[model samples]
Target: MRSLEIHGIDDLRVVDRDDPAPGPGEVQIAVEWGGICGSDLAYWRRGVSGTAVMSHPFVLGHEVSGRVSALGAGVSGPGVGSPVTVHPARTTGPLPERLRGRENLHPDLTYLGSAAGDPHTDGAFAQTITVRADQVVPLPAGLDTRRAVLAEPLGVAMHAVTRAGDLTGAHVLVSGCGPVGLLVVLAARDAGAARISAVDLSSPARERALALGADEALESAADMSEEITVAFEASGAPASLDGILRHIARASVVVQVGNLPPTPISVTLGPIVSQELEYRGTYRFASEIEDATRLLARTPRAEQVITHVLDLEDAHAAFTTAATDPASSKVVLRLS
Candidate 1:
């Protein structure tokens, strides 16, 4: 089998590797479609940041959909040749904190494509990948592989929207018009948000956001109206962060779904204390992949989020395009 490995910063090589057999409780997926996530590009361009970095040569993909080629012992449910999307999360049952529905707070959680733990369980940027059977989410018939590849990122947006509480009839503002941010718009619209506004610096992305269900799109975050009751900060830009704080109505909820590096930025904490705003931090898909998948499957124009596709051999070109191209929303590697 051949796998694309990121040796270090800006170093990606397609190299030969041994085919992995499904271990007990695992399922091997013949990689069909691999979505190029922003994090993947970060790994390629900057090596590592936030929580994910390459310490050794390893595969780099998490948003994946494929057919079941083989199953490990004790794995049932979906048989071989079944089309499926995967929730690339690894966790040991429920921790004390997680048992209370706070699984994201698991004390010893490690993510796929991370430098920590076994770097051997390579990701889906290859001919095949073996994940825990439980991590796999078998999609129903008629879900195209290109659209199914978006399940992971959509899950992130779905979880963030649900966690941000009710948005029905609320004026919502989503900052950042990237894949996740655009998904946030879709989710918010599905949740019955009214007057949803998407903010981004890219004009083309703003247009895409409008098409995705944003009532209005703006290039300047500071120009956002002060009537926004919920502000989703998906752009890691410091200016966007400050703008969200200023634009959000009093007593509104501000969900930080974007992973922003620690930077010295000033904000008015007096409003948070006096007006009582909700500032929440959300991670990737955790316990809500199933719900997110259902939402994505039912949502109209879900496939429009995917803007480009390439063969597995063009993974390098896809990565480069994602890093430099704002017009490309979701880039997928079609393995089949």
Candidate 2:
């Protein structure tokens, strides 16, 4: 079997590895497409994402979809040949009261391709990878694998919208038009938002957002003259987050979906205090993978967001395209 490994910053290679067999309660998948996420780019460019730094070689992929090639003992649901997408986070430790129903908040969670652990957990970017059966979600009937690969990021967007509560007939603003930000636009539209506006420095991203469903696409939130009923911060920049806070209407909600750095950021809290604004932070996701799959099945335009695809052997070029190509939205690699 072949696996993509990131030995260090700007060091990625395709290496031979022993094929993994499924263990009890796990399933082996013939990995098909794996999307390169922003975090993956961060790791490739700097060997770190937020506070998590790579201390050893790591496999860098989490948004993946594939077909079941073999099943482990005691796994009964998804039979062989079933097409599926994976929920890459595995939680450990007892759940706290607030996190009991929300497993995404589990104090100790091990995520695939993450540097959070000392010995990084391998990710699904190989010819074949084994994962717990419980983490796999079957793709909807006839859903294209390319689009199905988006379920992970779409799930993140859905979870952000879920944190925003109901957006029905409300003006919504999405800061950052990256892959997740663009999907946030689609999610907001699907949730019955009256108007969907997006902000990003990339013209191509803003164009893509408009093509999907955004009513307006601005270069930055500072360009917006009107206040939004709800705002989604997906740029992970202090300036973008500050801009969103300035443009949101009083008593509105703001959901931070982007992964900000561990460092503290200074921002005005006068509006939040005086207006009684509701600010929330959203992590990976809870149970929105299924919803994201269903949403993708219904959204044909959503597929346009995938701008580039490459073979697994070209993983280095794939990472470069994803990290440097301003026109690229989602860059995926075909493993098999």
lDDT of each: 0.81, 0.90
Q: Residue 57 error for model 1, in Å?
A: 1.1
Q: How well is each residue in 1-336 modelled by candidate 1, as lDDT tens digits?
A: 877788888888888888899999999989888888877888788876565556788888888888899999999859999988887767775578434776656666666666656553467788888888888898866676667888889889988998899898998999998899999998898888988999998988998898888989998767878788898999777678877776667798999988887556666566677768889988775677777677777775877788889877787788878788868888888776
Over 4 Å off, model 2:
225-227
| TM-score, prediction 2 | 0.96
Worst 10 residues of 2 by lDDT: 220-229
Q: Pick the candidate with the highest TM-score.
A: 2
CA error at residue 155 for candidate 2, angstroms: 0.6
Best candidate according to lDDT = 2
List, residue by residue over 1-336, the lDDT tens digit for candidate 2.
Answer: 989999999999899999999999999999999999988999999888988899999787999998999999999979999899999999776889966668888888888899988889888888899988889999987687889999999999999999999988988999998899999999999999999889999889989999999999998787764658789999898889888777677788889999887888887767888878899999889889999999999899999889999999999999999888898999999988
